[model samples]
Target: MKKFMNFGVLALLGMALTFGMTSCSDDDPDYSNVTPPTVELAKANISGMVTTIGGKPIAGAEVTAKLGSTTLSATTNADGEYTLEGLAENGTYTMTATASGKQSVTGSVTVNKGETAAWNTRLSNEATTVSVSQTEETSVEVVTETLENNEEARVTTVTVIPAAAVEEGEEIIVTPVYSTDYATTKAATTKDFMLMGINISCSNPNAVLKAPIKLTFDLTDDVIAQIKPMKEVNGSWVEAEVTEEGEKVVFTVDAFTTYSLFINATLNQNASTEAISFAQAEYDNLYGASEMSVGTATYTYKMGSEIGQHSNLLGAYLAEILAQQMAGSTVKTVNGSYEINVTLPIGTALTLSGKQAVETTSIAAGSTTVSGKSYGKVSVTANTYNRQHNGGTN
Candidate 1:
């Protein structure tokens, strides 16, 4: 009987131990004291309206915003309104708006976290009204009037459109688009010249004329002497024959695209002749009969055997002129780049090898190559003197 009592006592001890273990197992870990990981939420948005300079709503305009590799796009509604959502907050986006029969516009906007940023784009289009009749030729004037910084000026461009250029009774509109963005426009031309005219485009896309259209610009004699009429062909500016008649400049265009007056000058004013010769020598040595690699394409720049070949010397002279023009500006090397301090108009940009510098407080800085030569740094600032007009009516 004493041995059976001891076995019962041992069984009771085992039951108590098992119960203690069961109670411990039932309790969960204290995860309440641990912190949770953070998750970022996209709460920023960009919304805007795309309209013409006259405040006309542009329907079917494609609006795109780019931030790094992320691109968000939207189409404008009938009201010309568009919105891009779920963008990262506090990020700046480069915005572009493009529509048929309109000049594409580009700008930038910064959106804050949990907020919608408003960015409006005003596209430029044909400003002149035309009524095509059964006439041999029609003449229309495109006028650009500007009142900037309390200063007012007017530019009037006259184009003699031949009847063969457009269909009879088909309305034609021509608009002279004025841009102070010299840096951007300068890239289209191989010449180193200051833009001092307007870019004129017709309402008709890719309109080629059976007969040459007469274009005229009114300007001071001094200005006309320094300017040349250029027409954009195949995305490059080629000099068109220009003549000074009284206080006006005249040129003929067989095709209507972007036409402008470029201020032509030699870069080495003191050594113009010698500079031309040296540049021609360099061109012959570097590019003549040899393939020059640009990006991924190789091009052979053929030159005539003449001493003053137009194409060969043209590129060199223009490059020298541009270099001389910027020589007076302040230059500094920053982070192994050339930084040039130049003052331009408010809307203008400083372009180096097709790369534009970002503007801040009227100052823009960038680094790029110029004519196969790399610069450590370069910059441009807004010219406080707003009266120095490069091109356009105002």
Candidate 2:
């Protein structure tokens, strides 16, 4: 009976041990904590009316939203409705709407989790107009009379010229006249401002100071006041004072005043008439007397006041002339690339020596046919200048 009791006790202990082991195994690593990435989802339903002050319905506008760096673009339907999909995490976004030849419309919208946001955009006046008015202001005009060596010079009485009507922020090209006898081919010089100053754009790369003698272009009053007692040295004019006042500067200049200018020119005994002879002589040897019709070629071209047309035409003319002068060369291709990553400038050709694919090329540049004789092939490559595509291949 004692042996039977020992067996029972051992059996009970084994059962308890087995239950403990099963509980430990059940507590193994649980993957329920490893959740999948939360995909943010949203949509945009935007609607708005665009009309002029006269209440004309403007159609076919484009609406866009910029959230952080990501952007969503959509175009308006004929009814002026736009819908966008696949928006990311909720955030505030800058919304903009635009149409051709119309002012752009803008607004903002805040999106929430799984929420569809509504936005409305309206556009206003989009045209730019300029008006010109002139104030009664003193003007200065200088005329050169004669010069007597470096010792004495006879300058005509300075006069006042009427201020012309100019639009605000417009550039006025002022040409200062100098006596024909004034020194030419000088080392460097400076000219002082005596009248008519205009403001300059600081960040404007187009704002520039240049000269024939001492002409001022787009001079502002603030610039003149700051640079008063202006002096010229080492070929450039330097302002004598600081006129910048806080963020705004005032430009003003005295009228009928004379500014001193120092020039570093070698006094040549030859006059301008003699200079023409030199021009004729140079051209005479190059193309003979026939090409020496060296008087001003007064052809009407697009340029500034001198040409009275578009200035871009001047550069186009030079490029065309250069191409025409090339001999025995037909532009096979203007731009060529071998590797997929390679690129070349327009009007440039790359010759592939070996193991390169052969591609046919074509041209569409505006060219005049002179009796089937091409002075030079004007190959206009795509994505280049204003000239039409002169050459290409499919």
Candidate 3:
């Protein structure tokens, strides 16, 4: 048996997804008018089958293939088979197969170019109970009831939620985020993305369940700005209204199926901060300015100005590097308030050389959080890269 779907959407629960980006560089000369390079890659083809834990094919089950910013879906045919093509090539992808009146099953998949990856999983009814035990430290052990034969089936540990029928305000699921990690600033909202949706089921399979359970997630305010809870149909996201209750984001999920949040990830926003100015100080040292032109960020900056440095946010750090690293010739900053339009590809580790100058600062110092992580500030004198940071190459 494969592992069940896990949302990892407990908001600031601290279970941050780790990023892995890779790139190459040279001596890299510093020159004005440096145009950072950009790369665009595509995924490959994939096929799969869907069935119930009882060994029956599920026709018309909605299957969605997601990787990076690309999402596509197709319905299973009468034979309970489906295929998703042109997915992100040579990277990790996730597939969710769901059907009406049945609990959805999600699984992880890896696809490489020219390789047709296959995904197969068993979906269980929301009310079915399967005994569970722990196998490996990272794996769950499950024992299922008899299938067509009287033989019981042993399965692996999967993410399971205990069953409960609610009269209305009890917490059905308590998703956690790293609450201790707070951000004074955020990645300039680059491109808005709908974080993937996931399915949750009761811990015990035999327990009866109902919808309208209150769901709460602990996330930071800036991240909350990028995403909202929603239901996934076919491959599109349908917005569902959610309420902000103090430190928690609360909403109602009607079924034991899949619920996804549309994360905005608004990198560059139209706003102002009290602590930062274009050039904070004169001794700040002179590094030529740079700009990331990805989306519609309508900000402006002056060359050779005392720009804010030793920043906390990666976007800010990225901007600082671009400014001084000869990525762009002219320096630029947001004139007043606007959005940023620079694009970074998904599914790769953005490895940058900090020379160990990356430090985490206190929340009061206008620190920014990247996936619940804090890096104090790179010294204005240190932290230089060899390349133009061409949006990170693969």
Candidate 4:
């Protein structure tokens, strides 16, 4: 009887323990049906300041950042500070800032995950000037002023308009678009050879002009000779007829949009010795010092120096020597330094014996040749050569 009671007690204890464990498990929370905690994703941001070209803070300026279809925007505070939040991380955004009475600026910035990228922009005051005219034919001189004190800086004149460009008794506004203000236009039209650029537009864009309008640009004759007038048409540049009017360049255009003076790179030159000499002097002046070597002797000179004054004579003598070599002739010179009057095509061989020699031959125009083994070759363009060498140490 004792053994039976012990076995029954052990069986009852085991069953109670299993039942308690089952109950506890059923009462516990159902984690499979409950929702899990959510985690926030990381994002990037862009911050910047907006100011005027003069460095003055621009309050209330609009700053925008765009990446594909997503666009974020912010406004500048009194301190010119702006913050664009919640941008896609590790992306490049095109940023643009704008303010009233100021030029808009655009740039690009990159942001990293959970970080703000800094961008800064400076807006320029509108450098364009507008004038109203009510005459049949009128002239407008557009002038740019210095930024510091608003003093007159550069002036470009537009003149000689027919009645068609502007209707009589109708007020028309003419605006001058400066390159500094319109950099894109300048870059597209001028490349690296721009001397001066002027943009002209009438209030009536559809006005049909019967005659061409004239423009006068402030430039020297030398500069005018090396450049040509170009007009912007449909976003492309086309050559316009240009003329030299005193120290200014005058060009006529049927339509007035943006006209510029660009150095003509393909311009052929029939340069005279005087012109070449002047150019050489100008180059020397710009670069401090320059030298020319002939026959193992080097001549060093600067602008306005004594040696510089003899550029024409030296150039002519060099040309004569080269011409003789090209024509299968020998050039003989004495040991002492002397001057010789050099005229082009001086009959093949030149014999210089410390005395002036005059010789003439027939050679092709605009032909430059170099031939010789004992003496290095010389290249010269002979158009009209008359060089006289007096007693000088050059």
Error of 4 at 161 (Å): 4.7
Quote each prediction's TM-score: 0.42, 0.25, 0.27, 0.41
Candidate 1 local accuracy as lDDT? 0.47
Question: What stretches of model 1 exceed 4 Å from their correct place?
Answer: 1-85, 88-94, 97-122, 145-151, 163-171, 180-207, 225-228, 263-394
**Model 2, 1-394: lDDT tens per residue?**
9999999999999999999999988985432222212111223222333332222344677778788888988776554445555566568878887888665655576764333344543343332222212454333333321111211122222222223333334433322322111112221232221221221121223433221112232223322222243333333344433234342322233321223322221111111110001111111112122211222111110100000111232222212222211111121111111111223232222221111111121111123111111111111111111123232221
Misplaced by over 4 Å in model 2 are 1-49, 53-56, 131-394
lDDT per residue as tens, model 4, 219-259: 55434555557777776667767787787778776675777
**Runs of candidate 3 exceeding 4 Å displacement:** 1-43, 128-145, 151-394
Query: Distance (Å) between predicted and true CA of 360, model 4?
Result: 56
Q: For model 1, how many clashes?
A: 14
Go through the candidates in order and give the clash count of each.
14, 22, 49, 2
State, as a TM-score between 0 and 1, how close model 2 is to the true structure.
0.25
Q: Give the per-residue lDDT digits (tens) of candidate 1, residues 1-394.
A: 9999999999999999999999887894432222211112225667666765434567999999998998999998886767676676468889999998777877787775533455665566635666655557789876643212111124467887776566554555565654423224453443335333445455566554556667888766544555567766676666777777798888776565666766533222121110001111111111123222211111111110001111222332233223223211112121111222233322222222212121111110111112311111111111111122132110
Write model 3 residue lDDT over 64-164, tens digit each, in one string: 87878878898877656666755555677787888886657565777764334555554555433333222311112223321223121121113333343
Name the 10 consecutive residues with the lowest summed lDDT in model 4.
301-310
Clashing pairs in 4: 345-361, 346-359
Please list the Cα RMSD from the true structure of every candidate, rounded to 1 decimal place.
23.2, 31.1, 29.0, 33.0
Better of 1 and 3 by TM-score: 1
| lDDT, each prediction | 0.47, 0.31, 0.38, 0.45
Please give the lDDT score for candidate 3.
0.38
